[model samples]
Target: MKLKQAVTGMAVLACMSTAAHAQSAGTFFFSTGWFHLAPQSSSDPLTVTSIGGSPTNITEANTGASLSSADTIGFTGGYFITDHIATEFVIGVPPTFDLEGSGSLEQFGKLGQAKQWSPTLLFKYYFNAPTASFRPYLGLGVSRVSFTDAKITNSNFEANVLHGPTSVSTDSSWVPVFNAGFTYAFDQHWFAGVSISYLPLSTTAKLNSTSTTVVGTLNIQSQTKIKLNPIVTYANVGYRF
Candidate 1:
C-alpha cells in the first residue's frame, strides 16, 4: 500500500509540472538593434531667402539638399499577452541626415544635422503555426519625435545678384505614425524582422543671416509640412525569459 501511494503522488506532481509549462508556452522578451530609415519621400518645402529681404519660395521637389537615409539605433521591451497577441515599447535615437545642395552655386558639405528621440507603443499579432519558428507578425503604433541640438554651417547663396551666405535653423514638433512588419523566429529565443512606417512631420524654421556681406538681422519664418515614408529594415536578436 505504501509503494502504491508513493507512485500515485509522483504521477500527480509530474502531471502538474507539464501543465504549468504548457500554460507558459509563450515568453517575455527584450531586443536591441540598429535601424536604417530611408526617406522614401518628403513633402516639406525647403524655403530659402534673405532674412530681412523678400524670401524666395522654394517648393518641394527632387531638387536642392534633401535627405536620403539616416542611421538609427533603438531598444524594445515586450511581452506576449498570448501566443498570438503582444505589445511593446520602443525607444531610439533619431537617424542622422544630411542635406545636399549648392550654396549660391557652391556645393556645401553636409549643411546641417537633425537628431530625434521617440517612444512608441505598439500592438502585435502573430500568425499561428505548427512551430514557433518562422512566425510572422504585424504591428501598429504612435510616436513622438523631438528634434534638437541642430547646427548649420558652410552655407552660401545668391541674393540681389550678389554672392552671399545664409544661416539655417529649425524647431521640431510631434507627428502621427503607422507601421507594419513581419518577424521570423529562428528559435525559442531568437528572431529577426523588417518594417515600414509613415510619419507626418511638419514644423517652422527661422532663417538667420550668417554672411559678412549681407548686413542687418533677418528673421524669416517659413512653415514646412512633410509626410515621411520610411522603409525600415532591421535584424534583431532577442532573449525570451
Candidate 2:
C-alpha cells in the first residue's frame, strides 16, 4: 500500500513540473513596454568647412551641444531557438530629442531638436530552468541609428551666429548594444520584464545656410561631430504563444 502511495505522489510532482513550464523551444512571443533614453552626450566644436562653395577654416567657441533625455513606446517580438536561447527584434516610435548648448554656448539654453530612429536585433541567452517563474538574461545586438527633422530652433543663435536661415542634415550609422534584463512569469503565457541597454553611438550634423552678404550671395556650410552614448531602459509585459 505504501508503494502505491509513493507512485501516486511521484505522478503528482511530475504533473506539477509540467504545469510550471512556461517558455520552451519553438515558442513565439511578443511584448510592449515603456522605453526611456538618456544620453551621455558631448560634441566637437562647430566648424565651418566651406563658405560660398570654397573651403574655409572657421570654428565657433562653446558651440558644442548636448542631448536631453527622451521617452517613447517600445516593442519586442521573438522566437525561442531553444529552451535557453532566443532572438528578438526591438523597435519603437521615433522619439524627439531636445538639443541644448554646451560649454561656452551653455548660456543660450536651447540649441536645436531632432528625431531619432534605431531598430535593433538581439541574441539573448536566458538563465535558469524554463519552469522557473523568474529568469534573467544577457543580450548582444546591433542597432541601425539615424536622425531626421533636424533644425536650429533658437532665433537669435540662427540669425546672429549662422548669418542666415539655416537648414540641417545628419549622418547615420550602426552601433553595438549591450543589454541585461529579467522576466517574471505570472502564469504559463503571461510575463513581465525589465531591461537596460547601453549603446556607444555618434553622428555628424551638417549645416547649410544662404545669406546675401556685401560680398554677394554666399552659401555657408558647417558641421559638428556628436558622441551620444546612451543608456536605455525598458519595462514590459508579454504573452507567449
The sequence of per-residue lDDT tens digits that candidate 1 reaches over residues 51-161 is 446667744343334555887787888877776777888877666666444333224545556665667788877775424456667777777766565545443332421
Model 1 misplaced stretches (Cα beyond 4 Å): 1-26, 43-64, 102-109, 129-131, 157-171, 200-203, 210-227
* lDDT of every model, 2 decimals: 0.58, 0.91
Candidate 2: pairs in clash: none
Report how far off residue 233 is in candidate 2 (Å).
0.4
TM-score (C-alpha, index-matched) for candidate 1: 0.68
lDDT (tens digit, per residue) of candidate 2 on 1-241: 9999999999877755653445878878899999999999999999999988999889887678999999999999998899999999999999999989888778778989999999999999999888788899999999999999999999877887787889999999989999999999887789999999999999999999888888788899999999999999999999987
lDDT score, candidate 1: 0.58
